[model samples]
Target: MNSLFPILAIVRKDISVWLRQPTSIAATVLPAIAFMVILYFGAQAVGRNPVALVVQDSGPHAQELINILSDSGAFKVTMITIAPQKAEDALRQVKVAAVITIPSNFDAAYNAKKPDPVTIHINNLNLDFTNDLRRSLPAAITKFYADQSAINGNNSPIQIRVKETDLRSQDIDLLRFELVPNLVLLLTTAGIVNAGLATAREWEDSTIKELLLAPISKATIITGKLLSGWITTLLIAAVVLVVGAASGYLRPAGTIYWISTLVIVLLIALASAGLGVAIGAASHRFQRVTAIGIPLSIDLFFLSGGITVAAFLPTWLQTIAHFVPTFYGTHALQMAIFYSSNEGLILDLSVLGATAILAGVLGVLSLRKSMLA
Candidate 1:
């Protein structure tokens, strides 16, 4: 109880200091908010594309084709008209990605079993948009043929069927999928900035000498500092988790899954807090610690699969990401929150637990050495 008093006092003092500093709080929270805003806008850009559809044939077959294209959930058919020149103008002005025309001979070709090509003029500006247009057209056409086969019995030319089986109960949208990493980023920033600033403040305010002279052991000081940061991070994380759950982004399977999520979050906060202590002790200046901590956390966020899946990255980049602690953190979080499965979770927890221990030890040693120096 006597030794614990110093640790508790240190934690209390550091947390009080953190609460008094508004800049430190903003520095921790704003980056995660900014990233969420960026991802929201990015999701809009990559969603369904706009295209022009020119229908020259006033036949039932053409009308059916038009309905299929509109309902395919791929293209936003911005303009539907019989005017080829109008489509040309829209294409030239970059108003649409492509001009798809169902020619006058479409009905004639179908009745006579003749080959009639539906003309498409693509903007071909970039591969992403270009490929989207290319793939969507074929899929729409396949659906059209499938419908025709159903109506006309064995007379239809092509028959292709696709049956899908989903591994999970729900589909995670792009924005929601990204929310996990942003939450991780928030916890990491809070942990590092809170603890780092607390440690650096001692040097900046000329209070390190007092701490060195105090009756508390160096280990107690380090533990107190880390606990303060970890506690602060967990508070921030709680708010984030509540918001995430209320917004429908995070849905744990049951009590066990919720427990798993909390464990992962706790380990992440501890590891981040330890790293923060090391930075603060080594830099010994408020500005220097802030500078180092923010950029380093951001880099770790990206390397740990920020907005994109690490598996889809270049081979060397994926290899580097595996070395990052947050890679395991991110993977574990996604599994628990989204998949509701424990697959590969053991490895993730093991890595995070080990990292927390190693970082804590490094932080303690670094602060102790600084105290002696």
Candidate 2:
């Protein structure tokens, strides 16, 4: 009880100091929320993009393809009966996201069983817009064939039947689910940098030297600092979760899902706090902490697949990322919230738990050594 008093006192003191500064809370939480808003608007823009549909064939087959595009609802189709050059001009002027040109021989080639080509001219300035066109156009073509086959009672030579099964039992918004996990990693990175900066501030203000003279053990002091950081990170994570929930991005599987998520978040916070403390102990200046913390946080985020899809990374980088704590943290949250099964959950949790313990030990030892010197 006697030894615990110092740790408790330090925690209270740190919390009080943090609560007095509203700017700090704003700095930590607002940007995360703002990013969520940006994602929501970006999704909306992607959903309803307009495309130019240039129809050179007036035959029933050609008109059927154009009708298929209009009915798909993935795009707003503008039928351009004018010259293909005018359609290309529309694309260049950004009046449409893409231009789809149906050849004059489209119906003739279908009847004669010859090759027919449909041209699509699109601005590749935005990769997302171009990709959307690529996907939607093919799906429209498939639908046209299916519709024709259904109408003509098997007279059409080509027939395609699609059997769709979800990887999970329930439906998930692919874009929202993918981006929300990245937001969790962003929150963790912010926690690490914030904690490191706060710890370095004590040295900058000469208060850490005074702390060295206190009767409490250095271990207790270090634990107290980590505890304060852990608490702050947990609060920030709560805000992020709330934002995710409000955005309709996160779906709760059950109470256990949330409970497990919270546990993983706490472990991540502990690891981040430990890393921050180690950086603070090594660098006595706040500038050094900022310099080290920001880049280090970015690297961790990149390794954790927050910047890009993990499967797309190089083989060596993918191997290296396996050792990164945030990788496990992000994976754990993704499995808990997005996936229906507990596949890989135990492995992810074990890695995070081990990382927290290892980092905490090193951070405490480093801080004790720095302060005692």
Candidate 3:
């Protein structure tokens, strides 16, 4: 159709514009990286936190456990030979993260092979110590002794080591949760630029009029603008996704799952662009655009559940959340990118696709005023 050329030419010019304007590229890429990088290091430090310990042990095995805990360097072990009353006071005042009490009968329990039960008093919620330190000791020592005994022909598979991961998504720790968030930022920022300003900017600068005056029908001109923004947003998403996958963030959740996620993210960008155009076209001032667009952009991303959970909200917020595309997109992206949640991918795809279509229609309808003019 003679109509299609205007759209194509518009898209071509848009890409060329961005390529020439290096600031545009930096704006989109740098902010997402900053958001992700800041949190990754923070989470790593928090999760691997060191603790302080108060030990009340003097016997050989007690000394051995103390030495092991000390050499492991997970905690700063303090030698507390003080009165039990003093130790209790110190613990109550939060002077230590945890206290280990080895009963005077500890050696009796070890010699009787009944196992010495060391009481662990924890004042903090660091489960790493619970899961790996106190819990791991008996098994580790048993294995160590058993391996030594095996050299003497004891012939017993007496000790076993079991490794467990966080079981969240993709065997990645809470740290890599950054990928989805960074991507969402990428989507939303790009969406606002493409949707809010791209089409409207052209119209404002009289570029749209020139194109319209040239040969493009009003329909093709609008479609081309919408498509241009959509392609730009998606192209960035795809590049980040490829980098994420190669960086071990992509981590094939499932073939279908990944495909659907890709579709939904693109669709969300398109819809967001349409909403941007509708909003931008309605106003002539950048201040009004930011006033209206920035708040909506943030609200949509938050509603998307990229970082927050909808279930935790009061009923009304969650009810309104159903209207948010990022809510569905994030939920779906999580499934496709991390959990490989199969059902999640399909549900997200359908929801996002519907939104994209609706938004595109809105952008097209937004152009009716231009047509009339």
Quote model 1's TM-score: 0.90
Clashes of 3: 4
Better by lDDT, candidate 3 or 2 = 2
Candidate with the greatest lDDT versus the true structure: 1
lDDT of 3: 0.67
- Model 3 error, position 117 (Å): 13
TM-score of each: 0.90, 0.90, 0.71
| Candidate 1 C-alpha lDDT tens digits along 115-148 | 9788889999889788888899888888888888
lDDT of 3 by residue, 11-37 (tens): 899878877778878777766666556
Tens-digit per-residue lDDT, 1-373, candidate 2:
7769898888788778777899977888887787787777776655666788878789999989988888876788765665887878878888888888899899999889899888877777888777887888888887887887889888655555778987767654445655645665655666567677667777888999777888988778898888887887888888888877775676547899888888888888888888777888778777887798788777877888775666578999999989887888877787788774577889989998998898788778778878877
lDDT of each: 0.85, 0.78, 0.67
Q: Which pairs clash (backbone N, Cα, C closer than 3 Å) in model 2? A: none
Cα error, candidate 1, residue 144 (Å): 0.6
Which wins on TM-score, candidate 1 or candidate 3? 1
Q: Which has the higher lDDT value, candidate number 1 or candidate number 3?
A: 1
Tell me, what's the RMSD of every candidate?
2.5, 2.5, 6.4
Candidate 3, position 67, lDDT:
61
